[model samples]
Target chain A: MSAVLETRGLGHDYGSRKALDDVSLTLAPGEIVALLGPNGGGKSTLFRILSTVMDASRGEATIAGHDVRRAPADVRQALGVTFQAPSLDRKLTVRENLIHQGHLYGLRGPDLAKRVQVMLEAFGLTDRAGDYVETLSGGLARRADVAKSVLHRPRLLLLDEPSTGLDPAARRDLLRLLQRTRDESGTTCFLATHLFEEAEVCDRVAILDRGRLVALGRPADLVREVGGEVVKLTSDDPEGLAVAIRERFAMEAVVADGEVRMEREDGAALLTPLLAAFPDRILSATVARPGLSDVFFRRAGRAFEEGSDA
Target chain B: MRDQTWLPAFSLWQREMVRFVRQRSRVTGSLLTPVLFWLLFGAGYGGSFRPAGAPESSSFEYFLPGTVVLIVLFTAIFANISIIEDRREGFLQGVLVAPVSRLAIVMGKVLGGATLAILQAVLFLAVAVATRSAFSGGGPGPAGALEAAAALVLLSMGITALGFVFAWRVDSVQAFHGVMNLLLMPMWALSGALFPAAGAAPPIRVLMAINPTTYGLAMLRHGLGRDATGGPAPALAAAVTVGFAVLAVTAAVLVASKRRKTA
Candidate 1:
């Protein structure tokens, strides 16, 4: 079957800086694709292009068989977008926002009111439908934004960091809502997030770094791709120990945040070697299965810290 | 194809109108500013000024129509401020990304602003009649009232279109305000709003003749029996206003549509 959304060699630039470069992606119907990248990796730029907000400097994009550039109205009609920022009108009630959004998509009169009511109920906003959006909690507001996006029941839904400011419970509620939306509406979802937990929820994820696609696969497959169990060793002289371990065992190790992490089939075997090789210099050692953070580190050669550009 | 076309356009227009109604402050604040201008300025200058042609009327009577024009002008100019705010808040992006025509978005905004201006105009007229018995005493004859209504509608349409153009081209609020102030204050001053443009200096009169607001005010003055400049050439003035309105709205639609394509 044809993809619900696709981009070919997409690129965008801001004067001298490259926001998105030679990026390509596709999403199939009923699939939830998570785009994970470090800050400034061009995820937002890609999102903007796909949503028809920014024009790609070079490349072609299509939504449900319609060219984004040539038939933007069709693309827009086929998709729903929830921006990262709060777009709800603070002065208007939640129901009013939904109603206005419905009208924009050609739903009106009894039909408009019915859609608003359905959205309010689906998002658990029925009780607060009449309250001004400014009075809603952050989570409620975010949910309202999502509700607004889906009021027209587009074929594809694009959400940019939907979990940005929600609490743990709210985040879980949002994820559940997303899952329900996919199950009920069969709407292909493209979610952009920096949160690994959110990425893990997707059917598949594409890891990006510095405007480049580093890896793309199921989350479990990505974790497994980083290879064997990881053993982390900290020493007073981490760099020296890393070099010593590599020289003695011919194993690759990376030193970061005062710890030297290495991949091996048997983490315990490496632990003895590491202690024996470093002896007095070794302070602590721990071994565990690789997680998403380790996968990102191994692939990007850097830690996943906030605000650090790839 | 035409059916699909008009459906989204009408939907967008309806949405914009609903937004205007839901946000009562936007409508009320617009009316309040002009009423304040009338109350403060009209009271202060009520004793000194005399109508250039009608020596017997109070300054308030002479100033009423101009004040009403000022109300429409201020509301129309500031209406664009909401567009700037919508851009910043990303609501504009939401609308732009939807399955609606760019022209529909521009028309919706212009129509929305015009609707607000109309409501404000009615409120202002009502208040003007209530505050001063003279305004109510010989209120425009039925024909005159109808003509005034038509002129107000056309004036609002032109001003609203211009405002949408400003909002579309200028992405930042500060930039929108600066450009609007530079363009609007002079037009407001020279459009015979405060005094007759006929007696102004040669340069000022020339500038007024070129200002679109001057045509709007002239049309309005004729509706009130104070000037004959708009009656004989009503079509000419309308053509000028419509020409500018079309140009502004077209520019706005092009920019918005292009932004969406690239974005």
Candidate 2:
């Protein structure tokens, strides 16, 4: 299958700081790929480069077979972008914003009106068509932004933290709309998000840290590869307990923020041994299946929480 | 997409018009300053200055045409603030990522700004005609009115294009206003709009010579039953205004297209 969007050794720098360092990835048609990263892990830089909003210092990008640098207009035609911040004109109504967007893509007349209506209804925004976007809640404004991005039915959709600031309900609605766009239109979807729950919804996920792609695969596969399950132990001296567990079990233990964590093939089987090994030191213990968070921590040597300093 | 360029242009233009209509306070505020200038300046000097060859009309007669140009100037220059806001809001990025040509984007925005300028000019003209009938004792004829409107439209096109080019590089609203004031105030003051440019310092004359608004005001005066000033041919004034409009618009398109390539 042909890739809808591809980057070859893409690198970008902001002054002395490298925002995206030698990054390369591809999204095949009809696939949903989540870009899991910390705040400054180059997710926004990559999105901006892919959307043709900023130039890369080195390397190449192509969207739907058009070179991003050499033929930006063609690339722009093939891609749609939804930014983290809402971009809708506050003075215009939701329907008017969509219509104006349709014009930008060269759609008009009865056909344009029909497409606007379809998008409005599809995104559950039909009833608020005439309402000014500025008056809409944060969630509704985000919906309008999404509606504008896809008005042209672009082959590739790049969403940069689309669910930020959205309530849980709005986030779910937005995700459903995104899935529908992919399933119904077969458009490749590239999403950048810090939320693990959001990443879990994608078909595949790539974890980026400090401008590097540390891991990439299906979320479940990454979790399994990192180890089967994660066991957490909290104690007065987690560092000492972690060392003791590693020496006794011949397994690696990670000490993070005063918590002892380790991956085990089986949580229940490993917990009994762990408890017996350090009965007096262990204050509390919990075992659960390895998740995306654990996978991220295992690969980056730090929890995702530390990376959201922005 | 290939055949209906005007559809997009018109839609963008209509969007701007609707915005101006919705923000009626902004419209009134923008118009108020220039109208005040007309009242204060026109009344203060109503009896002092007279066109050497003017047909024995009141000083307000000549002031009315200059006031019209001032209104257009204020409207076009201040409309650029919206461009800064649009950039901050990411709306410009949304438009840039679309399939339309970059030229279309610049043209659409310029057209929108020009439309707003024209609306403000109409409002100012209506007020001028209503409150200062002495200025239009003979009443501008249909042909003269058409000529004046044409000159105003061309002036607006040039000003709006210049504003767009400036807006492309300015990221903040404060920076935009600073640059606009620096550029617009000098152009407005030295363009013979507020006072005659003749016999001014050589530097001021030199400044007026390059100013597109100078030609705009000259053409407008000729179209509004005032003396031609025997300075430049009417054809020359029209040509200069059209030439500036073309250059400003072309520069705007080039900047936008370059931004698209590097973005």
Candidate 3:
């Protein structure tokens, strides 16, 4: 089967500043992929471009075999988008929102009603179907937003920061709903998210930093690629300690937030050698297994939390 | 391909109607504010002034047609605020991402707003006619009322389209309000709504002549059987009204279809 989505050298610029640069990726049918990035990491820009709301300054993208820039109508027919902000009209009821969404996609009469009912039931919004969206809680509103997007049963679903305002339980429920929908309908899903937990749950995660796709793979595989264990040391002069450890030990070390971090095959073995080499420089030391944040730090040269606004 | 335009357009139009009906404040505010303006302006200018060339009538009657125009103007501004609201609330983005055409979205929103404005204008006109206030002594017959309704349809379409253009560009309702005050208010003030063009200075007369809104008010005045000496001819007013509506709709469609380089 052909790829559900594809991008080649996709780039966008906001005047002098670049939002997305030479980024490219692909997704297979029924796969759930997360475009993992912090704020201002070009995730929203990519989302806007893919959704056909904004034009890329450079490169090309396609959804379901139709070019996004040249054939937005076709792309729109095949794609459903959930924005980071709630898209349900506050004055409209949950069911009204779904029905309107169906009308936009050309589903009418009984067909539209049936699809809306199915979506409401699937999203657990049937009880709240007649309630105005403004009365809904954050999670309920998000479910309505998602339900509105998928009411037309597009082949691919794109969500921007789907878990931004969702509580932990709601987030879990959202993931389960998405998984069930994909499994049952074979609809490919792509989401842009800054939350590591959300990314970890996806079938694959694409780590983006400063408009660049630094890493893309399954969360476990990406973490494993960091190799062995991660060693962290907090010192009075973390920058100097990082350099000294790098030069003396011939190993790469990154300093972030007064802590120096390094990857080693046996982090425990490196701790003894580090203490022997610089007994006064090190204040505290820790050795742990690698995770997605470690992988992000290794690839992006910064912690995931150090994100600025877009 | 299927008829992609009207279904989505009608859906959007229907949504606008539902929203307007549900929001009681919008209905009351759009109607009440203009009536208040009409009453205050009529009382304030009652004994001191009478429009030149118009037949003998009370201040309240002189302001009736203008008040109807005011209701349509107020409704246009009031209804198109939903455009700003939809954008801020992210609902517009959802519609944009859908399979609907840009033209359909434009038609949906513009027509939706126009429909609301026209409905409110007609309601206000109906109340005036029923109360016998539309004409104190001599009034336009049924045919004139029909012509007035037709003129209002065109005027509301044009005014609502203009509002849509502004609402699409502004980011906040506050900013849209500022724009309406600065742009739309001046357009209404100089459109012969408050005063006849015959009494204005040459420069103001020039301004009135060029303003498209002047034609709308003239059309309204003619439909109401008022003396229209200071305004354009009835035929000219009708042509300009249609032209204005077409131009405004085109501008709205263009603005809606613009693609930005950044989100």
lDDT of 1 by residue, B173-257 (tens): 8897786678777777777777676556788878888888777776666666555422226666556666666677777777666
Q: TM-score for every candidate vs. truth?
A: 0.91, 0.91, 0.95
Q: Candidate 1 clashing pairs? A: A53-B263, A54-B262, A54-B263, A55-B262, A55-B263
Task: For candidate 2, write residues A91-199 as lDDT tens digits.
Answer: 8999999999888777878999999999999888999999999899999999899988988899999999999999999999988888898888888889999999999
Q: Using DockQ, rank the candidates from best to worst.
A: 3, 1, 2
By lDDT, the best candidate is 3
CA-lDDT, candidates in order: 0.77, 0.81, 0.87
Cα deviation at B95, candidate 3, in Å, is: 0.8
lDDT of 3 by residue, A181-293 (tens): 89888888898888888899899999999999999999989988888999999999999999998899888898865689888899998888899999999999999999888
True contacts kept of 2: 0.66
DockQ values for all predictions?
0.49, 0.48, 0.81
CAPRI quality level assigned to candidate 1 from its DockQ score: acceptable
iRMS per model, in Å, is 3.3, 3.0, 1.2
What C-alpha RMSD separates each model from the true structure?
2.9, 2.9, 2.1
Query: Clashes per prediction?
Result: 5, 2, 0
Give the residue spans of candidate 3 off by over 4 A. A243-251, A269-284, A308-310
